[model samples]
Target: MPRASRLAAQLQDEYQAEVSLEKGRGGVFDVWLNDQLVFSKHSVSRFPEDGEIQSAVNAHLAAN
Candidate 1:
């Protein structure tokens, strides 16, 4: 598993949004947020992917 996938799994336990990684065309990976499109980039760019996920998680936490 990639670092981003590992971290996202951890985040999911504390947040309401669902997280998953989908292997995409040209070996790219996509980060899905609440079943919506969010971050789609190379698997190597995990930090930015995590950051984007964190933003959505934080927003959901804030609203509740």
Candidate 2:
């Protein structure tokens, strides 16, 4: 939960993005941007490293 909060803060601060956190079961953790899936812990079987999700969001923002 703390990690999620930090990630939200980082995204909001860095990209001016509106972030929302949804409760999930079974260790689910994902990051989405603009309705696109940026990162998924379930798929990767691990959490994102520090700025991984941020980088993904940045790339998505730049592309679109």
- Compared with the true structure, all predictions reach lDDT values of 0.59, 0.88
Task: Give the distance in Å from residue 39's predicted Cα in candidate 2 to where it truly belongs.
Answer: 0.2
Best by TM-score: 2
Q: Please name the candidate that would achieve the greatest lDDT relative to the true structure.
A: 2
Give per-model TM-scores: 0.47, 0.92
Give the per-residue lDDT digits (tens) of candidate 2, residues 3-49: 88899999889888788999889888998877889899999999999
**Shift of residue 38 alpha carbon in model 2, Å:** 0.6
Candidate 1: clashing pairs of residues: none
Single out the weakest 10-residue window by summed lDDT for candidate 1. Answer: 41-50
User: In model 2, which runs have C-alpha deviations exceeding 4 angstroms?
Assistant: none
